[model samples]
Target: MSQGKRTSQGKRTSRGIRTSQGIRGGLLRRHRDFRLLWCGETAGKFGASVSGVAMPLVAVSTLHASTFEVGLLSAAAWAPWLIIGLPVGAWVDRLRRRPIMLTAAAVSLVLFAGVPVAARFDRLSIELLLAVALLTGTAAVFFQTAYSAYLPSILEPADQPEGNAKLHGSASAAQIAGLGSGGLIAQMAGAVNGMFAHASTFLVSLLCLAGIRHREPRAAMTGPRSSSLVGEVREGLRLIAHDRWLRTLTLFGAASNLALMGYQSIQVVFLVRTVGLAPGPVGALIAATGAGGVAGAFAARRVAVRIGTARATLLFELGLSVFALLIPLTVGGAGVLLFVVGGFCVSAGVVAGNIIKASFQQRYCPPELLGRLTASTAFLSYGTIPLGALLGGALGTALGIRTAMAITTAGIPLAALILFFSPIRRCRDLPTSRRPTPDSTRPPAPDGEPALPRP
Candidate 1:
C-alpha cells in the first residue's frame, strides 16, 4: 500500500476508536473533564439555591423587612447584569473562562461565609445582606458569561446537546435538593448556619473546577492588536441587533423573565401571608417546581425532534407557561396544589427552552463571538429582572399581593406571543446562520435543518 493511503487509514482507525469509546460509556462515566465540570456547576447551583432561600428568610424573619424591601434585595442581586454585562462580555472573550469561574467561586465563598460571622457578632442587617447578595451576584454574571462560552470548547458539536441537557438536569436537581434542605437547616440550625452551608458548596465547586484539564484555545491574535473595548462590545450588540433570530429570542427572553420575576418577587410573601404556609413547606413547594425542570431537561431533545426545534420552543414557552395564571387561583388546603401545578409547567417549559436555546447558540454562533453573544443576550434577558421585582413589589403593596400576582402571572403567556408573531413561528427549525456580511470571511454557521430563505 502507498504511504499516503496507510497514513489516512491509521487516522480513520483512531477516529473510529474514539467514537466507539464515547458510545460505550455515557458522558459522566466516560468523559473525565465533563464530569468534573458538571460536578462543579451542580455544586455551585446548590449553593446558590440555598442562598436564595436563606437570604429572603433572613430578611423577612430576622430583620422584618417589608415586601418592597424584600423585592429590592432580590433586584439588587441581578441589577449588575444590566449595569456591567456588556463590558464583562468583552473581558470574558479576552480571557480564559475557567480562571474566571474559579475566581468568582472563591469570592462567593468568602462573602457568604462572612454572613454567619456577622450574625454571631450582632452586626447583621438587611443592608449588609443586600450588599453580600449584590457582590455575589456580580461575580455570578462573569462566571455565567464565561461558562456559557466555555462549554462549546470542551465538548464537540455532536455532544453539545447532551452536555447541555445533563448540565441543566443536574442544576435543577441541585436546586431541588438545596431548597428542600435549606428550610430545614434554617429551622434547625438557624438561617445563619444555612448561609454557612451555602458557603461550603462553593468550596466544593472551587475544588472540582480546580481539577478540570481542558484549556481554552488562546484568544485569537489575528485582529488589530489594539482593539478598543467599546468596539468589541459594540460588535456583540450589532450582531444581535442585525440577526433576526437572536433579536426575536432576546426580546422573548426579556419579556418572559420580566413576567417570571414579577410574580416570583412576591411569591414567598403571597404564600406566607395568604396561603398561611410555614417556611419549611414553602421551601418544599418551591422545590417541587424543580421536579418539572428535571423532566423538561430529559425531554428537550425528544420534543424538539418530534415538533421541530422552533415549534417546540413556542410550545414550551406559550402552551405550558399559560398555566402560570393558575398560581393566583391557589388557596390554603387543597388549593396550594394549583400553585404547584402551575409553577411546575412554567418551570418545565423554561428549563427545556433554555437547554434548546443554549445548545442552539453554541452551534450557531462563531466561536470567537460566543462570550459577547451570551452577555448581550443575558443583558437584555436579565436586565428586566430588577424592573419586574420593583413592579411586583409596588403592585403587591398597592393592590394587594393576590391581585399583583394575578396580573403578573397573566403576562407569561402574553410574552410568548412575541415569538409566535416573529419569524420563529412559520419556520420549522431555527436558522443556523445570519446573512453573511459582504466583508466577512467567516464560514456559514453549523447547518441544522436546512436554512429557510430569509424572512
Candidate 2:
C-alpha cells in the first residue's frame, strides 16, 4: 500500500492543518474525500434545520393543527429511526454509499417539494405532510449510516476529531442560522413556499454531495451474506451488545434521548403556562438552545482532548443532570433563566457525546459495519423517543406539566450513573493504529478483537 496516502472525497484542507495519525506517524491530515463528504453532509443538515422550523410552522399555521397535532408532526419524523434503523443499516452496508447518499438527498428534496406543490394546487393535507416527514426521516437513516461508514477512510485517527468537528459544527451552526431564517422566510413566502425552501436547500445539498468521488467496496462488508436479512441485522445487534462499553454508552444515550423528547414535548406548554411567556419568547427560547449548541461544538475538541473524550462526556452529562432539575422551578420568570442554562448544558453534553461516541466507534469499526452498527446504535437508543414523548404528554396531562417534566428530568441522573460505572469513563489513553490502509471499512482494533474497555 502507498505509505500514509491520505485520500477521501474532495475534502479541501488547509496545509497548516496537521496532526499525527497513530498509524502512519505522519502529520495530522484530512483527506480530500472526507472533506467533501463532511461538506456535503453539513450542507444537507442545514436544509434539515430549515425543515425543522418550516415543517412545524406549516402544521401549526397552515393546517391549524392543535398543539397535539404539532407534536405529532415532530414525532412522525423521529419515529422511523426507531422503526427502520437496523434493517436500513444492514442494507446500507450492502450498497455503495455515494449512490445511496445521493438518492437519499434527491428523495428527501422531492418530499419537501411536494408540500409546496400540493398546497399550490390546494391539495395539501396534514396526512400528506406527515407522510413526507416520515419518508425523509427514513432516508436520513440511510444517508447518515453511509456517511458514518465512509468517513474513516480519508484521514489518520488523529484527524477524525477535527474532521468531525467541522461536520458537526456546520450542523450546530445551521440549527442557529437555518431555524431563525426559515421562520423569517416562511413568514414572507407563506407556509407552502417555506416548505419549498427546505427542498431548495436539499437540492443544493445534493449538488455538493455529488461533487465528491471515492471508490467503495463492490461487495457487502460482511464476509458472506446471511440467508436472511433479519439474521444479518441480528449480527449487528449482537456485536453492539457484546461490546460492554458501547452497550453502556448506548443505554445512556437512549435514556438521555428519551428524557430530551419528554422535556421537549411539554416545553412550550411550560413556557406559556408556567413561565408566563408568550409565543414569541417561546420561539426565542428554542432558538437560544441552538446558540448554546454552536458554542459547545466549537469547544468540543479542547475539552475532549484534555479530559479524554470519555471523561469529558461523563463530566458533561453530570452538568446536564444538575441543570435539568431546574426545569420545574418556575418562579417569577425564573423558568426561562433556568431553561436557558439547562439548554446550554444539554447542548454541550449532546455535542460532546457525539464527538466521543463517533470517535470511539470509528476507531473500532470497519468501513462495511458502519451502516449496521450506526443503525443498531441509533435504533436502540433513539427508538424510545416517541414512547417517551407520549408518556410525557400523558403524565403532563395527569400530573400537571411541571410535575411530569420533573419526572422526565430524572433520566439525566440515570445516564450519568451509567457513564460513571462504565469502563469507558476511565479509558483515557487514545487507541493506536500501526497500519496505513486507507480503507474506511476496517477490521477490529485491539488486534482483531473488540477494544472492549475495562469496567
Candidate 3:
C-alpha cells in the first residue's frame, strides 16, 4: 500500500504521495502522524487504567459505598452509550473527527480534575462521583465513535492491521503499567490524588493530537447537509440489521459484553471482601490480567494467520472465556492463582477478538458508512454494559458476591454460542470483500457465508 499526502486535519487528501522516496520505505517507520496518534492513545489509555482502579477505591474506601452502589457507579459511567450513542454517530458523520476528539479530551480533563477539587473541599459524595463518571463517559462516547471512523482516513488499507496491532499492544502495555502505578498512588497519596494523575494523561493526549498536521477531506464537513439525523441514523441501523455478518457479530458482542461487565462490575468488591486482597495488591492483580491483553495484542495476527481469523475468533471467544468460571473459586492462598488465570484468559481473548474484528470491519465495510456502522454496533454492544452492571449489583446484593460472580462469569462462554451457531462457525476465514446479493434474504454463497449488505 502507498502513503498519501496529508491535509490540515490529519487525514490523507490524495493516495499518490510516496513514503519510499527517502529513508521512509519501511511500514510505519516514517509515519509521523501515526506515531503521534499511537503515543496519544497510549498515554490516554494509561490514564484510564489508573482511573479504573482509583474510581472503585474511592467508592469502597472513602465514601464507604455499598456493593450495589459500586455497581451503580459502573453503570452510570457507561449509560451514555445507551442514551446518546445513536445521535452522536449521526453527528460524527457530519463533523470533522479531530475536532470532536479534541473537545472530548478537553472536557474529560476538566471533569476528572474536578473530582480531586471536590474531595479537598469536603464536598465529594456518591452523587458527585456518579455524575462525574456519567459526564466523562459521555465524552468518551463521542471521542470513541469519532476515532473509529477517523483511523481509516489516516492510513492505507494494507497498513491497518499492523497499525491496529501496534496501537493495541501499546495500549495494553500502558494499562499494565498504569494499573501498578495507580495502585501505588492510591496506597501512598490516596485515591483522590490519582485523579490528578488521570487528568495529566488527558493533557498529554490533547497535546499529541494538536501536533498532527494532516487535514481531513471537505466531504466530512458538508456531506451530511442533504440528510436528516433520523434518516442517517436509520440508514446505519438498517445496515446492521440486514447484514448477516455484522448482525451476528453485533449480537455476539452485546451478549459477551453483558456477561463481561456483569462480573467486572463487582470484581473489586469480590477481591477485597471475599478474596481478602488489599488495595495495592488488587491493583497489581488487575495489572497482571492486562499482561494477558498485551500478549493477546501481539499474538492476534499470528493466531489469525495460523488458524485463520474465523477459527481463531472462536478459540478466543469460546475456548478462553471458559476460564472465567475459575474466578469465584479463589480462597486467599495459592488459590488466588485461580482468579488471576481466569481473568487473564478472558482479558486476552476479548482483546484479541477485538483486533481481528476491527481489522475485518475496516476492510469489509464501505467508508461512507463506517461511522454509522461503528456507532450502531456499539449502541447494542456497549449498550448492554449498564444493564450488566445493574444486574451484577442487584445479584450481588441479593445472592452474595461469590454466587453472583459465578453466575455472571458462566455467561461469558454461553455468549459465544451466538457465533457458534451462525455462519462464522463453519468458515475458516471471514469474507474480505462485499458481494451484492439480489436480495437481503438470499441463501448463503458457495463459501457458506451470506452476501455482505450495502448501505
Candidate 4:
C-alpha cells in the first residue's frame, strides 16, 4: 500500500460517506442484519401501536368502559412484565431464543386480529376486548424479551448505537403512521373498521417475521442444563444487585420512564380542557410530540459523539426539566408554537435517555444474562410509565389540570436528582473512545460476539 494508493482509498471512503448521507439511510447499507430484523419487526410494532389506541378507543367509545376497565386494559400489558419478567428471562436463557421470538410474533398477530373480527360481528364485549388485549400482551412480552436478548448477539459492538437508533427510528415512524391511520380508519370505517385496520397491521407483521433469515449461535452457553429456573433468575438478580453502577443506572432509567408517562398522561387532556384546543388540534399536537421523538432518534448518535452520551443526557434532561416546569406558565398560545417547542424538548430528552441506557446495557452486561438483565430492567422501566399515567390522571382530577401539569414537572428534577446520586452519572458518556472489553468472568455477547469500540 503506497501512500498515494492509501490516500485514494481514503478519499473514496469519504465519497461513500457523502453518498450515504445524501440518501439519509446509512444504517441499512452499513449493517444488513440489523436492517432485516428492523424491517421484519415492523408489522409487529405497527400493528401493536394501531391496536394500542384502537382497543382502548373501542373500550371507551363503543363499550363505555369505565375508567377502571380502561385501566385494566392498560394494566394487562405491563402486568406480565412485573410479575413474570425475571422468571421469563430465566426461562428464555434455557431455550433457543429465535424460535421463541418467531412464535411470539405469530401468536401476537392472531391475537390482535381476533379483536377486530369479534367487533365486526357486533360482539365487542368489554371482557372480550380486555381478554384479547391480555393475550396479545402476553405474546408481546415474549417477543420483546427474546428480541432484546437477540440484539447483542447480532450486532457488532461498534454497531449497537447505530443499530439501536435504527430500531428507535423505525418504532417512532411506525407509531406515527399507526396512530394517524388508526384514527382515520376509526372515523371513516366506523369503530369496527378500526378493528379491521388493527388486524391488517398484525397480518403484515406476521409476514415480516417470515422473512427474517438469521439464526442465533447454537453453542451459546446457558449455564448447566440441570440448573433450576428460579436459580437462574436469582443469579441474574444477584449480578445487577451486586454491581453498584448497574444498579444505579437501572434505578435512574425506571424513575425517568415513570415521570415521562406522568407528564404525557396529563398533557393532551390539559391541552384540550385547559389550553382551549379542540379535539382535532389536540390530537395533532400530540402527534407533533412524536415528531419530536423522531427528530431525537435522528440526532441521538451524532450528539452522543459530540458531547459524549453521558453529558448529552444530562444536558437534555436538565433542559426538559426546565421545560416541564414551565408548562403551567407558558401554554397559552392559540397555535402550537409553545406546545411544539415543549414537545420537541421532552421527546428529545426521552430519546437521549433511552439511547444512553441501551448503549450502557449492551456494553456492560454479558450475553448469557442479557435476557435476565433486560427483562428485570424493563419490569421497572416500562412498568413505571403506566403508573405515572394513572397517578397523573388522578392528580389532574384532584388538583386541577394546571396544577397537575406543574406538579408533574417535579418528575424531571426528581429524575435528574436520582441520576446525580447514582454512580453512572459520574462515568464519562458512553459511545466514546473507551471501548468495551469482554469481562471474561461475565458471559460473552451472543454468537461469540466480538467487542469493538464505537466512535
Task: Please give the RMSD to the true structure for each candidate, in Å.
Answer: 5.3, 5.7, 5.0, 7.2
Compute each candidate's TM-score over C-alphas: 0.92, 0.84, 0.91, 0.81
- In order, candidate lDDTs are 0.83, 0.69, 0.84, 0.63
lDDT of 2 by residue, 1-455 (tens): 11134543232222211244321221223355665676667667667767777776677668876555655666777788878888988887777767888898999988888888998898988899889978988888788877787666555655676767667767877776766666667667765676676788777777777776666657646466678889879978877766665677788888888888777766666665667764445555666776767767777777765665656777767665677776667544544777777776777677766876787677656555667888899898888776676766677767887888888877766667877877655555333332336432222233233554344
Candidate 3: tens digits of C-alpha lDDT, residues 329-380:
9879898889889989998898899998998787777677788888999999
**All candidates in order of TM-score, best leading:** 1, 3, 2, 4
Q: Where does the lowest 10-residue lDDT sum fall in candidate 3?
A: 14-23
The candidate scoring highest on lDDT is 3
lDDT of 3: 0.84
lDDT of 1 by residue, 261-316 (tens): 99998888898888888888888888898788888898887787666678889988
**Candidate 3, residue 273: how far the Cα is off, in Å:** 1.0
Q: Is candidate 1 or candidate 2 better by lDDT?
A: 1
Error of 2 at 198 (Å): 1.5
Model 1 lDDT at residue 252: 94
By descending lDDT, how would the candidates be arranged? 3, 1, 2, 4
